[model samples]
Target: MADTPNSPVVDAQLRRASVQERLGALEVEQARLRQELVSLSGELRLPGLYLTLDAAGTSALLVADAVQEVVRLVELEPLPGAPPHVAGTFIYRGSPAVAVDLAVLLGVTREPALDAHLVICKGARPVAVLVDRVRDLVEAPVLVEGTPDGDVALPWDGTGLMAGLCRTPEGIRPLLRISAVLVGSEET
Candidate 1:
């Protein structure tokens, strides 16, 4: 190959590959840091929000990272022909989102109170989980040996939807499976 002003000298493909390798390394480092942060929270025994969805004591919650926010319940537009569990649609941050009564979806009989609030879930697609009320976060240390009383049966089992009960000072609280709640097992 003869050198000429118009001829490029460097191997562009090799340079691009080098940058990609660096990016991959950075992503792995980011994941590790995230794990460390979660571990630190566990060590501190930090409190987390747990909800009482029904009078039967069927409670639920998402991982702190999976929760976006808890907002006041407002009028929701009914989704015609939709399942009873569907509370209709609400505008979330200017985007249309379906409001779901977790109790209804779970086949719980109790009705939500007038002051019930909506839980904004975070994931591939955000969805609203309507609960009776939002309780302040509680420190959730894993229980070694205690009978959890409020475990709600899902429509189906064997799918990682149930996270078991975490014994809190108040009582046993059911952990919500973010994937199952956000995207139902049928959808999955």
Candidate 2:
């Protein structure tokens, strides 16, 4: 719609109007893309951090968004009159949080050997879980009963701490539901 010889360049008002129109169009497109993301949410799998635990040669895993950091092992100052699962406490994030032994909680053993690693979980009720080994964190797919396809699924027998199992390259690893594990523990 150039009416003058320099309409495209000389008309500062027209240039501003053109830019505004394009910006508005781009904003609408952005909103549409966000809605598309929401619609396709079911198919998109979130990255999950899986902690592989080898408690006395038995392999297990903890799967949840609760994992904060894996710090080097340190001597735990035992909480007087605390449950056997609660090993002790230490300064985490400038505050004290209870140390939990995953093996003891799962009944694998009375206490997991404090040799190398600690999984510090962050939350309102922050606590450190003791594991024999803290394996590398991987982008775990959405955990399933068995395999992705309709096949053998590990039934929740309520004897273990995991909510379900994720079939990993190593094998099917139990996904520990941290909330459930923490619930039944004696907090007194």
Which candidate leads in TM-score?
2
Local accuracy of candidate 2 as per-residue lDDT tens digits, 1-188: 65685775668656655664564455446434533553566332335666676554555666546788888777889888888777788888788777777667656655455565778876555577777887765566444433334564333235445545555677656666565445433263
How good is model 1 by TM-score?
0.60
Model 2 spans with C-alpha error above 4 angstroms: 1-47, 146-157, 184-186
lDDT of each: 0.58, 0.61
lDDT of 1 by residue, 13-132 (tens): 455446545644554464355446545664323255554343224555455656788888888887777777677788999888877777666666566677888888774455887877
- Can you give the TM-score per candidate against the true fold? 0.60, 0.61
Q: Name the weakest run of 10 consecutive residues (lDDT summed) in model 1.
A: 141-150
TM-score of predicted structure 2: 0.61
- Candidate 1 residue runs with Cα over 4 Å from true position: 1-57, 109-111, 143-161, 185-188
